[model samples]
Target chain A: MVRPRYFFSETFISLRRNFFMGFTAITTVAITLFVVGFFTIIVYDIQGIISSVESEVELAVYLEDEISEELKDYIEKEVLSWEETDSVNYVSKDQALERFREQNEGSDILKEIEGNPLPASFEITLSSPEKIDQVALRFYDKDGNYIEGVNDVIYGKNYVNKLFSITAIVGTIALLIIIVLLLAAIVLIFNTIRLSIYARRKEIEVMKLVGATNWFVRVPFLFEGFFEGFVGSVISIILLYFVGNFLLIRGERVIVDTMRIKELAIVGSSGVVLYVYIGVAVLGGLIGILSSAIALRRYVKI
Target chain B: MNMIEFKQVSKIYEDNTVALKNINLEIKKGEFLFLVGPSGSGKSTFIKLLIKEIEETEGSIFIAGRNICNLKSNRIPQLRRNIGCVFQDFKLLPNKTIFENVAFTLEVIGKPVYEIKIQVPQVLKLVGIFSKINSYPHQLSGGEQQRVSIARAFVNRPPILLADEPTGNLDPGTSEGIMKILSRINLIGTTVLMATHDRNIVNSMRRRVVELEEGEIIRDQKRGVYGD
Candidate 1:
């Protein structure tokens, strides 16, 4: 059998002969990888924003003016009995009045209210912050309707649920984008390899005619594809680093400022990025070579 | 002993066109055989079958001792290496240097670079193309390119050389020059099977001639001169 060096030399010569087509193919692969990379950043950015908002809201339960102080104390103990309640802070009418007055610091209308008209209230904080709705249900009146005087129960329900749903939707959309981009990458690589093979179709046919074994003809094209992909992937990873940094500068908190996000895009996702770059480059090259090799199946006569 | 033996070979193209009909012939080693016919008279079809380019419709073609008709498709390349073919178009690889083109057959067959380095130039010299070793096919004249094609065929030292209208594009002088090269190779004991209609070439060479008419062999004789 001929040595592998011979096949590599031929493949190298073929690549040099049609440098432009190979360049174009590499460019196509790079673009596909970039699209996949960019959208990944966007998906991460959106998710970070939503989780930040979920950490702050709490539910407030208002008491009726007619309810006796003893019953109010009993309700406070009952509220604390639930495992879901993180903490309960009680405020008397006078304390509520004082707090309202303090909040309206510069307003003269605060002095016009001669009496302490505010009701006592309980500020409910939940363990999960996500179960605000169920906790609010416990604040219902005897008739089982929403309490009349309860101004608001603001414990993280809206924010948590909203972020959760939005993240789910965005996550799905991002996944769809990734899948579509991946498919496009494969097709593009396949076509590029196919065209490259077509460019050297005669050479391949001649090789077959001269009694070159199947591997003899196949190895070089595979190498060409691999080289193309390797080069393209290197170019892609370099571009992604700069681009990722630019996005971070434009403000992705996930992109730390101390890190020149552009420079760090490569380093920040170092582990994932390396895997992606090498995996993609190798994948791109293999796909490109295999496509053409397979296409040559019918045309390579004895 | 006969090096090539065909027993009732026929070929029907995929398009249903009958290209060869019941061809039975023998080609001796160290002898030059010419296959002659008009257009569409199965000359090319016969060559294709011998090289395993196209399968026989219903027949057996034996090269050396092996029946090529029964060989598997993957084995065709192996069969082709034993036979050298010169196409009408002088199908030299446009991208390759004359030397590289010539050496390709040997290279594909897993010959060592050192051997290729030695034999390729020898074959090119044999075809009077040693001077144009570095030249691409397009840079050479049609005749010169055909010489490169011939050199490429013989570089591997194939047992049989098949020339399909090798001089189809050359003038009479170039054709005579090519014939001289073939005759020289034949003198050195390489079997040759060429197809042509040039009567002058046939008469002057006085080699064995196999004539095909309407897909059937009409004549086969020693020292034949373009027999009808």
Candidate 2:
């Protein structure tokens, strides 16, 4: 037998009467959610950068200059058959000389080279960047000696290991910070709701004396909390949409132009922005309702 | 049949202050009674017990022949709906208009809009405050605000009405007007129990009077004056 019209009207009227308090509550929610949204976007962008950088990790396996075409083909197939290997491409000695000349087109280094002295090599990408060392080690025997016709394997093992560990640490810290921020937002909302309840205590007393059920007295306040949260979250989402776009565009430009690392540039897709908006809005509303419920438990005695 | 009964009821506060001790009283349906006492005589406690605001430490209270001592906490609201209450300060919501203040009572009980529209104005007119239906509590005089509060208390037509010093803050003339309204409401067969300190009102009404002293009833008389 709940009446929606009456409850809503009551909520609106109370909100109007306590305009200053309601405004304060809404502002607090908006600012807290805004910070949270910005942090989420930053975390997502960093993760994108880390994953792209991981994908660029590859092993260059140089071959002996006297190797036959059949042996080269066999090495390519063998590397590809490993579960961790994503793809492998064979570069001939002439192709390597051509790439060196192209990289130093105007330099005297190309003129100083008499004939092609580069060795044929296989460039191998891995499905899991962390397993790059294990894949590169496949060309050697247990005695750490290269197998027949293989010259040397190079994959920058030190930097790859350091990058994986750094990414893992960054991921853990980002998760912890987000959890702490969410808890802080909930606490701030709870205090704001408690203040609102204190201001309307007399009205609550009168309602109880007039035969209002505890729920009847509670519904209007709950609606007030939900309305405040909804409005606050919408405001934050709008702010985040504009500010996030500005930041992402500038950040991507700096990473691509100055650092010359195209893989580090974040792609701010519409789908990711939409998901962030929905998550922030829902979180704000739930915080509002939860805080209101807790505040009323102590104040709205029948 | 008795509309309210207190059987050997007692109430002791957490600080060990005895507010009421070994109280026994019965008020029948449609009767008007006055409770008179000095300060700290437990007049407020008597009214509070009827509404179950504070529980009795001993004995039972029956409202409409139901023992309310063992009534569950969730059922307290249902019990309160059967009784209407008024206060000395005219506890009208400062933000609500006279019409809304009256309508609020029915609204909380889930009355339909049409029914509330019909009933709120009718009760406002009953207390002679129909002209100020749209006026907020702060905009009205003390007597006018009291009238609005009365209208709110009577809107639901509960079986019992309790007023705690309803005229304590008004002048003699204004008090008389409030008394007349209470008397008129009583004429319609709604049992009223009012606690007051105004001797003039008690003497003028010539109704059943129960006087309390230090948490115990000192006198109960039919058509009793303020005192001998």
Candidate 3:
């Protein structure tokens, strides 16, 4: 306890002496941490949007028009029993034609048709869009032979594939960008702390000569770094709060309509905001501590 | 009781430059000894070895009966706290006031605030620099800065004091003041090991002198002068 108090006082004095250098360190930490936090928010929301969009795609499995009622019932039961199938609805020929006519209400071509040409189908919803191929495969044999009563299983193959590829690409690029940003933050924090340590090299030498324990000299520096991180994180969190509140008030309509975000969960949820602030502060503190520890390696040798 | 002992101590640099070669020496408690040597005669290495700043390539060192050569790195500071050190450069923290400079030693060793509050002034007064305690090192003359350094060294009242050319930067008049202070501390029963090249101080004091030539102790005399 006494050691902590002494370290705190020493840190205060050192910070005061090297005010500009210390300020640079804190400001750099704040700006970088803010960017990281913002990036995290964007990535999370994008992922949420992608998942929501994927859930809307459904497979339409058309049946033979001349198929027996018992065969249709069997296919329906088989699909429904599959673990990946969320739900399967059987549409009769008449019902299919009715839907087509309603969808094409302005067209008189369907009214002029001699007889109903539409095929009965099973509309299937899946637990996940990624399981569509597996569900489609079950309707056919391994040799591409369509099952006895099934004519076709269609789920917009090209569109679903494109959606998946795009999401994968976006995820990869975002991960790369986040990794680069993290590296930049570490280097900047390290350099800032190195400069601060350089300024006190002489004082450190004197301290060592006087028989100061390595920890005695190092603890104060560690605390100084921690304080810089704490101050930086606090300032950035305050900025984030104001920005979040402003975005919530001003961009609500745009976000809801275009981005399709559910109130921008990070902005709307008070609990989420609190967690983000805490995370940033902890990260800042950790960076400060690690950088200072690395910077002190050379100076503490004697 | 022996204040310090060296058993066949040798220090070889990475480049194989032998600084101290198979040297052996001992000093009893409360003894005042001057180590006289020319430049590059390994005076600095001898002082540094006592504090374990540089480990001996071979052999052992015991300070206050503790084997310092084999002492753990964590224990070096504890050893240093009991061994006061004064350097020729007057290695004071330039930004800190004279009072803070002395108090720093106690602070690092985790002494109580009240103890530091009492001890700092007392040591400064003993060194006769109590009035200039508030001044920074840059604000003082060479001699005054050296005096603050001495005050800081004695602030803990350690059992041993090591001075590596404490007056190296000062003129004869100022050097006399620094020597007198060291002698006074010595008379108070602190073992003093000072290394210097100053002929006048060494000859005038006529104290026990150990002269090193090329990392070898050529002369260890009672009431010895600086040189032949």
Candidate 4:
């Protein structure tokens, strides 16, 4: 039978006896988790902003001035039929000219024009911004020729390409950094546990000599490691709550003020942050347990 | 039945230093024997082998008719559970109280709390340290600490007890006190094997004596003194 009372009492006693070592281990875990949490929040917020921006990307297919009403309706319907197309609205020449006039109000350049040079076009929004290039290609034929009655398809090709590449690079770098931080945390925790074990080598020898099973000798240390990790993670989570809120509030204000957006959801609702906190705490505990197991393998010989 | 048997047992360390040469010895149940040797002799090695702390380079050993040479690693704890051990340093946990130090033996073996409550005080009283049950090891004198150590070893009432220089650090008066406790434990029908260099302790007891030199037993005699 496993005696939980004994294990818990032993864990607490040892933790108290080696207060300095325990303190060092807890502090190490807390600092590492805090840094990692900060980076995670940053990456999540950046991805949120990028995705919001990507949603605004659209494709504009300019039409011939003399195209038949039937051809215009056909073009609109065809673009809407594609799975990537979210919506397609036809803008007549008059509507296009009116929009330009409104945009360039109080400017002499609009008054200098005699007749409307703006072409009628179909403004298309896609379900997925990544498929904009492929959807735009559908406007052309086998020889790279524009389809009949279609003049040109423009989706700011250069800008979309740059955005995609930037997102990919940011994602790769963030993943690599998190991986390196996790490995470093594991190694440092392993060393601290090894030191603590070394300090109590005599205790272990005595325990073994008295016929304590290997697990009987090991369970308390494992509990110690887990407690350190759990406490450390709670500290980090509390710190992250304050720090994340401060930075995100300022960040939301900046984005809203400059970009004229009504609200910027940096890391989604509070519910998502709660889940992230849970994940970090679990990760912290697993690391502590793993490091303790590794350190004990060499020290707690039966 | 023999409590311990060593057949041509030898332990040669990795650096080619032989700690115990090919040797044979048998100890019967309830026997009290003293292993006498100088510092470099195989006294410590013999105790270590019985507990399976280190494997012998050759030959076999049996404890209670079980060959421990091929004993599985996981079963070693079971083997040790039947054998109590005492050391020269009196390896009591510094952080635990006298009561806790003795109670630890029963705790590791999954004994019930009620049993621990009854047995710990019983053993501590036997070693004459019941008055200091609440005191920590560091707070006690050398002899008091050794008494607590003996209580811890004998608490579970194992069949065999091995004491490796249990009085090596105590004065002659304290050593006599420790020997008295060991003799009392042996009187309860527990086989006792003690290794020591104290000539007075060996001479006064006059039990069976096995003397070792240079990793080999040079003398084995009944009703022996410290020497021939």
DockQ of all predictions against the true structure, Cα-based: 0.58, 0.67, 0.74, 0.73
lDDT of 4 at A246: 83
Off by over 4 Å in 1: A1-12, A54-158, A179-195, A253-287, A290-302
- The full ranking of all candidates by DockQ, starting with the best, is 3, 4, 2, 1
Candidate 1: tens digits of C-alpha lDDT, residues A26-130: 787687667666666666555444444444457777777777767778878988999988888998889999999899998998869988788888987777666
Q: Model 2, which residues run further than 4 Å from truth?
A: A63-78, A92-120, A136-151, A172-188, A262-270
Query: Sorted by lDDT, highest first, which candidate order results?
Result: 4, 2, 3, 1
Q: Which candidate, 3 or 4, would have the higher TM-score against the true structure?
A: 4
Worst 10 residues of 1 chain A by lDDT: A258-267
lDDT for each residue of candidate 3 in B94-153, tens digit (9 for 90 to 100) = 878998999999988888989999999999988888999888889899989888988898
User: How large is the interface RMSD of candidate 1?
Assistant: 1.4
Q: In candidate 1, residue B201 scores what lDDT?
A: 96
Pairs that clash in candidate 3? none
Which candidate leads the pack in lDDT?
Answer: 4
Clashes of 2: 0
Against the true structure, what is model 3's DockQ?
0.74
lDDT of 2 by residue, B156-210 (tens): 9998999999998999999999999999999999999999999999999999999
lDDT of 4 by residue, B53-76 (tens): 899999999899989999888888
Clash pairs, candidate 1, are A58-A155, A245-A261, A245-A262
Taking all chains together, each candidate's TM-score versus the true structure is 0.78, 0.89, 0.94, 0.94
Model 4 ranges with Cα > 4 A deviation: A266-270
